[model samples]
Target: MKLDDIKPDIVHDVTGTYCPVPIAETAKQIKEMEIGQILELIADDPGVVEDIPAWCSSTGQEFLGMYEEDGEYHLFVKKVKELT
Candidate 1:
């Protein structure tokens, strides 16, 4: 299924947060969720440029994709099985 089609079981809006903290929290949420779950992260922190991708790489979660809508950057990830 497409990234958007996968309903994120967990939604995290860390717009005001900064650095790796927000992305780390997103990863943490994913870790605590059930296998094959989805996590939708909406982060405004520019650090998300590196944080999100880094988190995905380290956790092995599927980094489906990210896009900008209106004035927000939306990141979509699927837990798919487990964090490899």
Candidate 2:
């Protein structure tokens, strides 16, 4: 499915926040989500462009991809592994 076509189970808005905050919040929110569920992280931090995908890869999650909208980024991440 297209990245835009996928609806997120959770939408975490970290706009106006800086690096680490976006990634930090994403990490926390994903823990409360179920497997296969998608998390849509809305962040304005440029760091998220690299951080989100890297974080997903390292954490064994699916980095679905991202898109920019209204000067903000919409990062799509899917939960693949359960928190231990």
Candidate 3:
């Protein structure tokens, strides 16, 4: 499926937040999501460019993809594993 065509189950916007904040919020948000649900994180922090994929990798979740739009980053993540 095209990244632009993806419909997220949840959308969290952390526009003015910086590094760690974006990641931290993402973790917290993902924890409440059911497996197979998609999360669309909108942030202005460039840190998410690296943080999101890395977080998903270490946590065993799925990093679908990401794209930048109008100075903001749009990250797509899928909950593939249940948080313990």
Candidate 4:
């Protein structure tokens, strides 16, 4: 099913490069979603291994899980609270 099928709280296109900019954009999108909703992040950047989880923990968002599909990384994070 499409990631959107999850009807995620938000979607972030972290594809291309896993630099700070895309990751930041992902965070921005996630922050814009509703609380307790899920955000699906599409990334291929290796830095996401550190960036994704770090951002989740640092901000108290719930890092539900992630998986690799084709050549991309699909990560899902639940917004447990609003960003400051």
Compare the candidates by TM-score and give the number of the best one: 3
lDDT of 2 by residue, 1-84 (tens): 798599999998999999779988999998999999999999998899999999998999999999998889999999999865
Measured on C-alpha atoms, candidate 2 has an lDDT of 0.92
Give the Cα lDDT of each candidate.
Answer: 0.76, 0.92, 0.95, 0.79
Candidate 3 residue-pair clash tally: 0
Q: Return the TM-score for candidate 4, rounded to 2 decimals.
A: 0.82
| Lowest lDDT 10-residue stretch of candidate 1 | 75-84
Clashing pairs in 1: none
Rank candidates by TM-score, best first.
3, 2, 4, 1
Q: What is the lDDT of residue 30 in candidate 3?
A: 94
Pairs that clash in candidate 3: none
Q: Name the best candidate (by lDDT).
A: 3
- At residue 4, candidate 4 shows an lDDT of 46
Query: Can you tell me which runs of candidate 4 are displaced by over 4 Å?
Result: 1-7
**Predicted candidate 3 versus true structure: per-residue lDDT over 1-84, tens digit per residue:** 789789999999999999889999999999999999999999999989999999999999999999999999999999999876
Reference-based lDDT, residue 15, model 2: 94
What tens-digit string does per-residue lDDT give for candidate 1 at 1-84?
666576777888888777767877886888788877777888787777677777787778778778777656678777765643
Runs off by more than 4 Å, candidate 3: none
Candidate 2, residue 38: the lDDT equals 96
Expressed as tens digits, the lDDT of each residue in 1-84 for candidate 4 is 444456665767758864887668867887688887888888888678678888899988987777788878888888888889
